[model samples]
Target: MKRFSALGAMLALAGAAPLAGAAPQPPSCARPEWPQEARRYELEGVTTLNFRMGPDGRAIEPTVARSSRWAMLDQAAIASLSTCVFPAETVQRVQGKLLPLQFVWKLQGPDRVPPALVEGSCAASERFDRYVPFDKGVSGDDGVLVRLLVRGDGTPYGVKAEAGGADPALAQAAVEYVQSCRFAYPKAGASPGSPVSGRVLLKQ
Candidate 1:
């Protein structure tokens, strides 16, 4: 079985008020577990999350300050960091401040990590933009789910898409969008012409 884990969080002061006295101890944070979906795709990246400390020492209003390229990894970072707890003294030192925490997702072992979707590709492509207007204005938070086969060379093919409880027309648009995009896998680790199944969630 493949193993995936996140590195220890790197913390930085984001507009945190200067301490007049001694610096407080660092907060206890539970790093996020790598998403299985990302693991299956061999995705890796660093996601930065920002949050304030609540009176009870738990993270408050945790939000992704910067995406890890993949939504799955970003969501995983937010969900896990929300459970972080600052010491009472640390909370006061950083009260009402948005602290930045960086979580890095890295695959363990010798196998090379597979390619991930290029940043700002696929659903964010110009092709997707052209199709969106003609999608009959079908828009919702419930994005379309698309499954497709990607060649070892990173070419996407045979997209099978489905709408998430919306009009089926969205599926057709998602198919075209997915096929137009590219993946970034190395030929050394991937077999040429070998087809692999890939999934993506397309949202407006």
Candidate 2:
């Protein structure tokens, strides 16, 4: 596993103050109550993120003042905070004000096992069969999982090695191959600019 100890320390130090060019500070207030269901997540080694609420009550910008090495934990914190419903009354009070909200991702317990495959509309078709080659580094090993975000046009916008047991070269090759492959666009409704997430498992 990649060690994030140094990154974590840096985040802690930066978290102590606002960014250099940030807007003036707002009033202090406790975090709004989150749903009971949100407490079920395991967020150990996660970062505590600070968000600035816009006049529309939506998160304007997110900054990781504190982070744990685990990206999953940081993502979870952002996800949970995204669903938060800030006080409408308070929002009106600070119509032009930028409210600072802090979210500490506390791990509930042990991390749960991730699902087998998080499929999306796109997949490796026969034309691109050669691109989905086995990861030679793990010829006799169990396997590794690579998660990627594919754009509506079938172009890969982002790639990450979800599980890193496989060789770095293999993971890079898979990412490059996937980026080169194209997919059929959605026929029904309008294509979304947002990325569609999927997983590729390289096994022995």
Candidate 3:
């Protein structure tokens, strides 16, 4: 899966960053499903949408300022971001806001977009606003793959190392770092059905 990206519409400066106060921006962790028809024919394009969010973390207008020229692609892009959960109050301090984002739909020639390319801003542990990996200058750099269990409200719990035999200290550090992170889930309220896990690559 090759990386493809384009600038989406920019929000007008009228509102500025909300004064609501310190909520970490939730990162995108999934991709909207590609239209089967589009995938069958190997259609690919980038859709740019201007989405509005309320203080309650719901999406308002999901208009495509820039079309992918493919209606199915555009709709997929809008629907996913429009309905997904976000940290409460969106921008922390801002009470209400408009967020414009661009979603690129590139077929992998394998039926689905790869998961690694799903979260645009999330980089393993870096996606969490609070999971800071330990850095030991020369002590030895080690890494662990952990499945971070994210609850409906975006709180990360059960940071289980997916593999065995990782250094105990390094693994423990990853768990602790993840425990410190928090997330906000939208309409689903406090629990988002079942536990959703995201894998994090931790290095120390």
Candidate 4:
């Protein structure tokens, strides 16, 4: 399931870029500007866009990037990139080079949590299970919410305790466990910035 989701996200991103075409090269590098409408469009939700920039600093090919399965927002992202431009230097340097760029669409109002941001359990059999609070005062029975950014292979790139009370010991333990763990790189198509949730539930 995880692999499929990642692949889907990649496909959406791949589809957003422009196809190769025969066009005259510009005489000099020019900074491409993002369409005003797309810029004004709110990316308040959980959406990731991956695109390629040309050596000329223009968004030669734009695609859906990555989205949280929200069609409306995804479409908006596609439309927005159509008008998006890159810096002249970027275009010149990356004209023939294919570099990945990501954009996270956020809304204008107070931050809103997407349904996908919900938490999930870390199986008892998982290696990190050893770090679970075993003592009465040490247990994270209320649960610990940690925001972990893992590489495609599932290795912890970064970790932060977001919520679930202020237990320094519990937080440290969780962070340590995560730091020691590694994950398989996501499937080839997974978006680079894909977000994964980790939940630690203590057992009595």
Candidate of highest lDDT: 1
In the range 27-89, model 4's lDDT, one tens digit per residue, is 232222233333322212334555566554455555644443334546655555555555554
What is the alpha-carbon lDDT for the whole of candidate 4?
0.42
Better candidate by lDDT, 1 or 3: 1
Q: Which ten residues in a row have the lowest lDDT in candidate 3?
A: 109-118
| Residue pairs in candidate 1 whose N, alpha carbon or C atoms collide under 3 angstroms | none
Tell me the alpha-carbon RMSD of every candidate.
8.3, 15.3, 19.1, 16.3
How far out, in Å, is residue 33 in model 4? 23
Best-fitting candidate, scored by TM-score: 1
Q: What would the per-residue lDDT of candidate 2 be over residues 18-129, giving only the tens digit for each residue?
A: 3322424333333433333223221124356766666665555666555543456556556655655445554555445433434443433333222222234335543223
CA lDDT, every prediction?
0.59, 0.42, 0.48, 0.42
- Residues 121-171, candidate 3: write the lDDT tens digits: 333454233232222111123344444445554555555543334566665
What are the per-residue Cα lDDT tens digits for candidate 1 across 51-125? Answer: 777888888888888765566778888887776776788766667866676777766766534445555555565
Clashes of each: 0, 1, 7, 33
Q: Candidate 1 or 2, higher TM-score?
A: 1
